[model samples]
Target chain A: MSVLTQIKQAPAANPIERLLLATEADMAKVNALILSRADSHVEMVPELARYLIESGGKRLRPMLTVAAAQLFANGTGTAVNFAAAVEFMHNATLLHDDVVDESDMRRGKPAARMVWGNKASILVGDFLLGQAFMMMVETGNIGALGVLSSASAVMAEGEVFQLAKTGDLTTTAADYAEVIRAKTAVLFQAACEVGAMSGGADDAGRKALAQYGLELGNAFQLVDDVLDYGGQSGTLGKNVGDDLREGKMTLPVILALAEASSEDRETITAALGDAEATADQVAAVVAIMERHNTLARTMEQAQAHARSAKAALEALPGSEMRSLLSEVVEFSVVRAY
Target chain B: MSVLTQIKQAPAANPIERLLLATEADMAKVNALILSRADSHVEMVPELARYLIESGGKRLRPMLTVAAAQLFANGTGTAVNFAAAVEFMHNATLLHDDVVDESDMRRGKPAARMVWGNKASILVGDFLLGQAFMMMVETGNIGALGVLSSASAVMAEGEVFQLAKTGDLTTTAADYAEVIRAKTAVLFQAACEVGAMSGGADDAGRKALAQYGLELGNAFQLVDDVLDYGGQSGTLGKNVGDDLREGKMTLPVILALAEASSEDRETITAALGDAEATADQVAAVVAIMERHNTLARTMEQAQAHARSAKAALEALPGSEMRSLLSEVVEFSVVRAY
Candidate 1:
């Protein structure tokens, strides 16, 4: 075969792709459970739910869950339930978030709210959360349940904290760290920790995996914040600089605001959270961030978290799973696409 | 002392009042647990949560939990947690519902969403739900947790169903029954069932309390529907016919529409979802309902459920607590104020 044909026939080329390939059998189960649980007699529940679920993002969170479980134990049954529950929690957050942010786009399509309305989005989010908790309860894993339930509460608090901080130029780097940890990293931590629990990992292994997931989550969110300013529209699943228009206090903005000249700062603040902001207005702010090296600095911060995440996996013995997980973190920080 | 003074000093005079007085000590603990659990690091979470929690409706749901538990066991300790969790679930629903309904008032005051804006209300509701699950997880009662988590999901489905049926003139009495059972009765049933579980009741007792709660809840909602037309403005915590204006398919509306002539039906339909419907317009609908005996018939339906609720208590052994519970049911349907 020609080289192009050979490449096409190859198994998988990258960390996330390889992870998906490795977890295919297990993810099929998780996906089935997710779809079955999303079903309801109320037709709209399944209709709107499937619209979002089938839109099909990377399913990264569930993948981490399945991966962590496999890393420790060989295909434990509870992992399927936990993985499904994690995905549900993640999607539930996304549904509520679109309403809160009043965003028009999610996963590069009109948001479920746009189709169904904000009321459905909120109620459906509630429905998914109920499903998530029911899944956890069904597994009869109280330990894992506790970790996830606590994480869920923290995530809500994080969102509230982030919402409160929105459009406030006074938001600091420390506050930004808190926001990222609570809103994003906590769930990742819970996902891995629960997977470890289901896999019957020992205390040290569970702690290490939890740390790895937490750090990876931090890196993932940092990259996302940077992407909101730097990535393509379809790539970000939203317009460029959505964070600015939403008044999100992302690392790039915080860093730029701290470093820019008074005149340049004026430019940034004017566009920050201005929903009517022109493309030129956002481009101007991006230029300010680039001049201050804030975007790249934010990437560096992501890299640091990725390093810590990779370091966390060292607690486990060397294995293909460990290496793949490590590479996932590394790719998260480095990839622009 | 004057006779009136003695009457006031003796004790609570009504069945509901007696429930309040009897459950006072336990309700205090439930309230304390509720206040403490509602506390959070995010300022707005606690502030909004407190605004709702402290707005202090009768605290009826938690009272049912505490009462059920007390009837079966003196004090198992888990009941307090369950009671607080129940209250949280309730407040979370109210916050979300107000946002869904675009309600300006709740519990005779400005709705939390009106005070804090829809975003804060939604986030805080989520935060409270998380805390509720955390409380459940902490109790380690998987059975009660299952009951509640499932009820939470059902409640969401019921709300969605109600929202879908809003202003839908084709709504049937059966559909209304399903909506009430899912949205209102299920939580009440859960509260009592979990309370019974925490109190270490036998299956039969647990079931009896659950039935009683469900029936009582049905009666309670029916009464609420009537009160929207019959009760004073401040008493309803919303204006008269707010339900009509919102196009809620309450029993009276459904019953009247089924019997009304096309001309009268047109009048009701026009005012059904009209937020701008004036007092005179609402009164005209009420007059139509009275002409058809629909409001009184709704009260009869409520009375039937109340009888069923009282009958449920017969399965339990006779006791002061059991009689008190029965009286609460009877009072529910009979009360006009």
Candidate 2:
């Protein structure tokens, strides 16, 4: 039986899983391409690379690329390459982000930087990025290349900006928005847009997919920020309060700080960036979040963006792929609940 | 007076200096493009970028790009963009290299990672690389882009290989050759090849330039390895015995190991990667190198590559630019003496 048939015969799958199942065949090709391209005669390059790439994250970004391409019937098979490139790009960022943040764990395992030294992590990340560009160039699509390249620059900027904001209580919600949009949303936008381009998307179709991806990405990050404080470690693949310890001023944090009483504000200010922050400190911060309804408010914002993501599908013709993409956006925010 | 006239009036400006003078006007434009593109409203990106970019080193790789393009009269101005891109690629590597090596000094000053921290260095390096690819795509030259993108992958592989070989006493001359070729020569090859492409070079012209750059790059790195032992800190922009302390099995070390007496071999191996290795230890290692004439032998190898670099230029038509390129090869090896 085909992979899709096998997936269908299994127990009920959620919307995102259903979307993934719908594109499993194409995504399998993408995975193979990623594996082949990630290889090097340099033993450590592939060893460290596979340690992260094969870690069981949802592969949501590449799946978006494939599903977006599936929205049109005119794909020229280049989407497989683009999808793999997107995954490489994402994994590259994760590798570097772990080093920059001094993160010990990723996807519930020791980070690549932890397993390998920081030197190997940095070089392997560079290798993956280099491979990503190679894949993009092989597509022979200059437009897609431009989109991905610009996203890379913007993402780096976002990261640097975030680093600069670390531990600064003055970081505003607008600043947080710019961070998420640049660091996270731009890649999603580029991935879906490139997929559409590979599928021979016209200007309108491409713009529609870009908008859809951007809104969905915003919603996804917003919920991710909420989960850092509200969800279990197993569900989040990381410790609770990681964002707080990293001094990342996510929307919920920004909102709580804005409305916090001086005592509660001091509590957060003391705990922010404290590596030794205890569980009680996290609970205290969550208590402040609850007092301001900041977590729920952030989820409400995510739901709004999710609505906008689904609304972007109106620009494209009605199709099963479009419906699946819309459903995936809703599922992204609903995970927070 | 113009830079060219000043260079001509000097009693004995080196061939490489003369080439820089010949291309001064074009390279100035390329420098401006680099500075402008390196900027970001995010602040730290530009701050860390300029810290390294403005650090005074001869912008040799970018100059090679411009000079190579100057060989042909039928040039589009795309070489300026390519030159800037080449410089960005080199700077990006330097930023990451400092982090990988835990280097404190670069170009006779504190490394960017020292001033801005490793996080900023890595992110800004990524920014520079992203900008480099953007410039390449802006040229709309897919072939040039392919050359650069592939060189990037090879360079990363070379770095990872070097990292793996760290402190490995079994590292062969052949392994060292591959390291330098991948880490250094490939960029030089791509820069010149793309310049030739921008100059509308025929296949033979492109191949000739590629060979010239590869041989010259090999010579350049061989001399660099030798300088770590023989040159002063001021001249080398780093302390003497840095390669030894870093456990890099460069050419001179490889040669010494091959011919050393058991006692001498043990002495050298003990000092390898020894951060606390004393002045006497370094002197002892140098004594072994002198006895075996390994340093001079390494220079002889550099001279051989330099000769080959000049020979490659013979494939091109006679022109002042071609002659200047040939002379620059001679100068690269002479720097060792």
TM-score of each: 0.96, 0.97
Model 1 lDDT per residue over B29-106, tens place: 888888898888889999999999988588888889988987785444698899899999999999999999999999
As a whole number from 0 to 100, the lDDT of residue A165 in candidate 1 is 99
lDDT of 2 by residue, B68-110 (tens): 8878766637999999999999999999999998888999999
**Candidate 1, A251-283: lDDT as tens digits:** 899999998999999999999888889889999
- Residue A145's lDDT within candidate 2 is 97
Query: Which segments of candidate 1 are over 4 A away from where they belong?
Result: A1-12, B1-12
lDDT of each: 0.89, 0.90
The ten-residue window of minimal lDDT in model 2 chain A covers: A2-11
**Chain B structural similarity (TM-score) per candidate:** 0.95, 0.96
Candidate 1 C-alpha error for residue A79, in Å: 1.3
Q: Please provide, for model 2 over A177-267, each residue's C-alpha lDDT reduced to its tens digit, 9 standing for 90 to 100.
A: 9999999999999999999999889999999999998998899999999999976556778889988988888998899999999999999
